[model samples]
Target: MLVLEGVSRRFGAKSAVEGVELSIERGSFIGVIGRSGAGKSTLLRMINRLIDPTSGRIALDDVDVSALRGKELREWRARCAMIFQQFNLVGRLDVLTNVLMGRLNKVPTHRSLMRLWSDEDIAIALTALEQFDMGSFAAQRADQLSGGQQQRVAIARALVQEPEIILADEPIASLDPRNTKLVMDSLSRINRDYGITVFCNLHSLDLARAYCGRLIGMSQGRVVFDGGPFDLTEDVARQLYGLEAGDVIDMPEEMPAAVVAAQAATPPVLAAH
Candidate 1:
């Protein structure tokens, strides 16, 4: 389980998050939605230790995440992989090499710097790529792939980390509708088949409703709503977005049949405890 108590972050005089309290259960697929500057990114970053909180504590099980430093902090990060809006990958590097970078935390610094990967590690990286249907592109440059394929490579990299939690910040923000569906379906499959806790920051309500079982709505750096997709009525969405009812687009009742079938076919993997 993950717990946050009275968590807040400040930048000079501006407050990014304030007095936030949340408890996230294992294997939950959660979507954090809000307008620009709603503190969604800050919240996810704090959970991943990419940014320090100004006050309060964040704990995973009994471990105080805020207290970790140095090698310990690095190890914690390895367990909590982060996916970014702009798929963070070395454009010039081959896809396989980029995926191998996930092993950096586990490998010796010298080996990582020299790019000396063992056959087993290479095999693992290839398997991760295959999981995302990108195995054929292993030798291609990351920049050579399309935007959606690049994002899949990013997901493959995260999978090789064998993380306990996956934090995706606006992962589909730059993709077209078709690519958005592909990426979201991939995330949903990972969350369901592997039983990995997924905390994603999303801009589209429709995507969130389709993929996430739980939705957390934030406004002005504070959570205004927390509930299942069904509970997010038009009124609640208005409150969350600070918009008129007519402006809020209603989400579909169910995900596309293809996405559901794909998830059903995914095989379960052992996830971190």
Candidate 2:
């Protein structure tokens, strides 16, 4: 389980995150949805210890992850893998090589620079590819695949680590409708098949409603709503987005204009968990 005990972050007089306290179960697929600058990304960063909380603690299975430093922190970070909105793959490297990169912590830095990986690493990378149904693209360079395929490769890279938790920061924000479903489906599969707890920050309400078991809404660094998707309502959405909710949703132009514009606007509505 992951625990956020009164986590807060402040930069001078501006507070990015407030006293946000939440607990996530071991296998829960949680979605964090809210407006931009609401501290959704900040909260996700704190889970992996990429960003430190100013006044509280984050724990992974009873371990104080936020307090871990140096080598210990590195090892703890290895337990959770992060998936970015933009697929952060080595563009020039083959897909298999990119997935193999997940083993860098276990390999010496010298060997990593030389791209020397053990046979086990190759096997694990292959297994990851198979899991994502991208085995045929193993030899293709990362940049050669389409955006959806690239995101799948990134997911494969994360799975190769066998991490217990995954933190995805608006993972499908850049994808088209078809690609978005593909990426979200892949993540859901990972959560069920491997029992890896997924904590995602998203922008689409429909997508979140479709996939996540639990939903969390944030605004200005404070958690406004936290519960199951069944608990979500128009009233709750209004609370999350304020007066702009109706004006925004009532906009008309295309079939998916609401989501298309939302994705393009300042205060985004993300999908996850």
What TM-score fits each model? 0.91, 0.88
Q: Pick the candidate with the highest lDDT.
A: 1
The sequence of per-residue lDDT tens digits that candidate 2 reaches over residues 159-255 is: 8877899999999988899989888989888987889999889877667756777788998898878876545567777777777565423322332
**Which residue pairs overlap in candidate 2's backbone?**
202-270, 202-271, 203-269, 203-270, 203-271, 204-269, 204-270, 204-271, 212-273
RMSD (CA, Å), candidate 2 to true, equals: 6.7
lDDT to native, each model? 0.85, 0.81
RMSD of each: 6.2, 6.7
lDDT of 1: 0.85
Model 1 worst lDDT run, 10 consecutive residues: 264-273
lDDT of 1 by residue, 102-194 (tens): 999878999999999999899999999998899999999999999999999999899889999999999999999889888888898899899
Q: Per-residue lDDT for 27 in model 1?
A: 88
